[model samples]
Target: MSLELNINAAIKTAMLAKAEADLRALRAIKAAILHAKTAEGFSGELSEADETKLLQKLAKQRKDSLDIFRQQNREDLAAKEEEELVVIEKYLPKMMDEAELKAAIEAIIAQTGASSPADMGKVMGVATKQLAGKADGKAISGLVKELLAK
Candidate 1:
């Protein structure tokens, strides 16, 4: 089933079960999807790739919000954001662990002949496309820097 359908069905299930956390997260996702459809310059066409990117973006946003909430000592808000983040993350591709990510980046560097940090842009361009949804940008960049420096 398409993710859109799953989101709608889950929303209904959440409502039926009176699952406040699930309901809130589902509603946020639905709203974001709707906004993406109507956003200016967007084609109103969300392919599987686009949807995956959307989910990743939402997860990142929730993580940022959760961070700020925790810093402010707002456990209640942080918990809510954490719950939503978990929901959003379930839809994203399984993230690559450090070992796997390092191996992949090593292969990419070898393929691209990235000998130094200066070639990071070239490596990153290809790596980002290759690793999209599977690895976070921060992790990729850090790994790339560490590998290239050596």
Candidate 2:
């Protein structure tokens, strides 16, 4: 089944199970999908890459909110954001571990022949397109810097 279908099914399941938190997160996802479809300049069809990007964006938003809530000592809100984050993560690709990330970055660096920090932009351009959902931007940037500095 497609990602959109899976999300809709999950929403129905959540509703039937009366899972409040799950339902809330699922609805949020569905809303995001619909919004994406209707956004100006969008082609009204989301590719796998687009879906992954959307899910990642949603997860990031929740994580940011989670951090803010924690800093404010708002356990109640933090708990809710955490719950949403868990649900949002279900649709995202598994993140690369440090070792896997290192290997991939090494390969990208080798392929790009990027040497020194001056070539960081060249390396990042390729890495961002290739890595996408597999890794976070910050982690990728740090690893690229570490590898290129070598």
Candidate 3:
């Protein structure tokens, strides 16, 4: 089923269950999807990859907010961000753990013959495309730098 349909069904279920947190997050996803569909230059449809990217962006935003809230000792706000992040992550692909991410970047570095930090751009270009949706860009970049510096 399309993500929109799944989200709508979840919204209905959340409403039935009186799940305020879930309903809020699901509605936010739906609104973002709708906005993307209507945005100029859009073809009124998003590919699966595009949808995954969108969800990842949302999850990243939630993580950033969660971090800031925690820094401020705002437990109540942090909890809300955590709840929303959980809901958003349900739609994202399973992320690669650190070890797996490092291994993958190592292989990409080998494949691209990236021997020094100067080759980071080459490694990043290939790693980002190969690891899209599987790992965070920041993690990949950090790993690439660490590996290349060795």
Candidate 4:
């Protein structure tokens, strides 16, 4: 099923289950999908990749909000954001652990013949493309920097 349809179904299920946090997250996803579908210059339906990107973006936003709330000592807000994040994360692919990420980056470096720190750009370009949705961009960039500086 399309992500949009799946999200709608999930929202209904959440509502029936009286899962307030899940219902909130699912509603947010539905709103984002609807906005993408109707955005100016957007064609008919959103591609699966686009849907995934949208969900990832939402998850990132929630994480950022949670971080800021924590920093500001807003425990209530941080807890709420964390709850939303958990719900959103259920749809994402399993994230790569540090070892797996390092291995993937190393392989990309080898494939691109990246040797010195000067070749960081080439390595980054390839690694980002291969690792998108599977790893956080900041984590990947930091790993690339550490590996290249060695």
Candidate 5:
């Protein structure tokens, strides 16, 4: 099923289950999908890759918000944000662990023949495309820098 359809069904389920946080997060996803669909020059439907990217962006926002709330010592708000993040993350692909991410980056660097820090851009270009939705960009960049420096 399309991500939008899945999200709508999940929203209904969350509402029936009286899952407040899940419902909120699902509605937020639906809202973002609709907004993207209606944005200037948007075509009929979003490709699967686009949908995944959008969901990841939403998940990132929730995580960032949760971090801020935690830093402020707002346990209640942080808890709510974390709950929403959990709900949103259910739709994302399983993320790569640090070791897996490092391995993937190393492979990409080998494939691209990246020899030094000067080749960081070439390594990053391929790595990001290959790892999108699987690994976080910041972590991948850090790994690339460390590997290249060595």
Candidate 6:
């Protein structure tokens, strides 16, 4: 089934269960999907990869908000952002763990012949394309720097 169908089912479940946080998150996702469909030059359809990207963006937004809320000592807002992040992440592809990410980046560096920090751009270009939603860019960049400096 498509993400829209899955979200719809989850919305029904959330509504039935009277889950406020879940319901709110589901509606936010639904709104994003609708917006993407109607956005100019979007062709009114989202491929699986596009859906994954959208979900990842939403998850990232929630994470940033959660951090800000925590820093501001707003536990209530932070809790809400955390709940939304959980819902958004349910639709994203599983992220690579550190070891797996390191191995993948190492292979990418070897492929691109990236020997030092000077070749970061070369390594990053390939790694970002290959990993896409599998890992965070910041994490990949940090690992690449650590590995290449050795």
- Which pairs clash in model 1? none
TM-scores vs. true structure, each candidate: 0.95, 0.93, 0.96, 0.95, 0.94, 0.97
Runs of candidate 3 with Cα error greater than 4 angstroms are none
Query: In candidate 4, residue 72 scores what lDDT?
Result: 100
Per-residue accuracy of model 3 over 58-140 as CA lDDT, tens digit each: 89999999999999999999999999999999999899999899889989988998899999999999999999999999899
lDDT per residue as tens, model 4, 18-122: 999999999999999899999999988888778878989999999999999999999999999999999999988789999999999999988998888999999
Give a tens-digit lDDT track for model 5, residues 45-108: 9999889899899988988988899899999999988888898889988999999998999999
User: Candidate 3: RMSD over Cα atoms?
Assistant: 0.9
Q: How do the residues 1-150 of candidate 6 rate in per-residue lDDT, one tens digit apiece? A: 999999999999999999999999999999999999999887856899889888988888999999999999999999999998888888888999999999999999989988989999999999999999999988999999999999
Winning candidate number (lDDT): 3
Q: Summarize candidate 2's per-residue lDDT along 1-150 as a digit string, tens digits.
A: 678899999999999999999999999999999999999987857999999999999998999999999999999999999999999999898999999999998998889888798999999999999999999999999999988888
Ranking 2 against 4 by lDDT, winner: 2
**How many residue pairs clash (N, CA or C atoms closer than 3 angstroms) in each of the candidate models, in the order given?**
0, 0, 0, 0, 0, 0
Q: What is the lDDT of residue 62 in candidate 6?
A: 94
Model 6 regions more than 4 Å off: none
Model 1, 46-128: lDDT tens digits are: 89998998899899999999999999999999999999998888888899999999999999999999999999999999999
| RMSD to truth, every model | 1.2, 1.3, 0.9, 1.1, 1.2, 0.8
Ten-residue segment with the worst summed lDDT in candidate 6? 40-49
Go through the candidates in order and give each one's C-alpha lDDT: 0.93, 0.92, 0.93, 0.91, 0.92, 0.92
Model 1 poorest ten-residue lDDT run:
41-50
How well does candidate 3 score on lDDT at residue 42?
88
What's the lDDT of the predicted structure labeled candidate 2?
A: 0.92
